[model samples]
Target: MANSSSTRGTSLDPRARRTRALLRAAVLDLSTEKDLDSITMSDIAQRAEVNRATVYLHYKDREDLLLDATESTMEGVVEAARACRLSVDTHALPDATPTHLISLFAQVDQHRAVYRQMLGEDGSARCATRLEHLLAQAWFEQLTAEPPGSPHETALQVRAHFLSGAVLAVIGRWTRGDFDGEGEDGGGGGGGNGNGNGMSVAEVADLTWALIRGQK
Candidate 1:
């Protein structure tokens, strides 16, 4: 995730900004030819034109830095969903739609190398699980923001956990090449687009969002 400078959108301090920019740039450059584990803070510092201490000042460890980058990608996803008001039916279409979810997936696909690499075998699954928890937290907050609900936030939390797994399962399969041609008819297994044809991302997103919105 990007380190917020201030509520007003002021840029970060020049030195801090420089250090961060360097680290980000270093990751991009080295990732092209080296294993993430093989890259070191010193290497990043040199690439960024900074020093080890400077790298240390901004991030705790290499994993921490990588997590920051992952957040950067996720930030884009959330932004897109917001653009469509994922919460509202402004488009007058289903909660999920081919044009909508595919657009988001396409963006993620744009960073396929980074995502596929970071999502080492079991890595993406874990990342998706964590991401779902964050979503659940946000969902819970929204639930509690107004009057008490009939089913309670705890119930919603459980639903969120299951839904998170479902979402991850779809993404995992897609990454493994399971849904290449699934399209809009392959989401619900066994073909027919959950009974139609090709499992489309927007369709799956709609299914996922339905669960989210319908949670007790």
Candidate 2:
């Protein structure tokens, strides 16, 4: 997630941008097809139709490129989390799950396979840590934006950390098929008809929101 390649100025050449895009696409596609540890730089280069040296020019290593490719997919999740009204009075919150929350889960659902691999037991620690950081930062911003009576800074930090951890755990387990039997889709759910688990997008969202709000 701390790739120097990503920090390059917006003025990067068009061809460079195209090359980076191809490399990212290649890594992401390969991730869904095999275990990440087995994907080498040469594998990505071949898939992207670029020379091995070209891949090195853009990314320091395979992990750097993999993170860059996966980072783009979390933008929607971050935005949705930032927009959530986490500070609202529990009684006043809507009975229905917020559309933003649903969108957050849907965003993850769309990239389920990649996420499943990344957040699994054998997944990348960098990827998991980066996701947790982004989620905590998003929730922290939203909490700070609450009107005058918001919690103290330390309290906010605790809440943000708690939220991010909880959300990440839910997402990881969901993606790993831990919840495949929780809904009507039957055991071992894999079809996109649901969230790739047994629950629908909204159902999972509601469950997550309920847990966030400390409801039973």
Cα displacement (angstroms), candidate 1, residue 11, comes to 8.2
**Ten contiguous residues minimizing lDDT sum, candidate 1:** 184-193
Give each model a TM-score. 0.60, 0.89
- TM-score for predicted model 1 compared with the true structure: 0.60
**Candidate 2 local accuracy as lDDT?**
0.78
* Per-residue accuracy of model 1 over 81-108 as CA lDDT, tens digit each: 3343332122333544445455555555
Task: Give one digit per residue, the lDDT tens place, for model 2 in 1-216.
Answer: 234355444677999999989988887888777867788998999999999999888777778887888886778888898888777355766777899999998888788777777787788778888888998998888788778886787889888998898999988777666776443223225533453436667777889998877789
Listed per model in order, the count of residue pairs whose N, CA or C atoms clash below 3 Å is 18, 0
Q: Say which candidate scores most in lDDT.
A: 2
Clashing pairs in 2: none
What candidate 2 gets wrong by more than 4 Å, as runs, is: 1-8, 181-192, 195-197
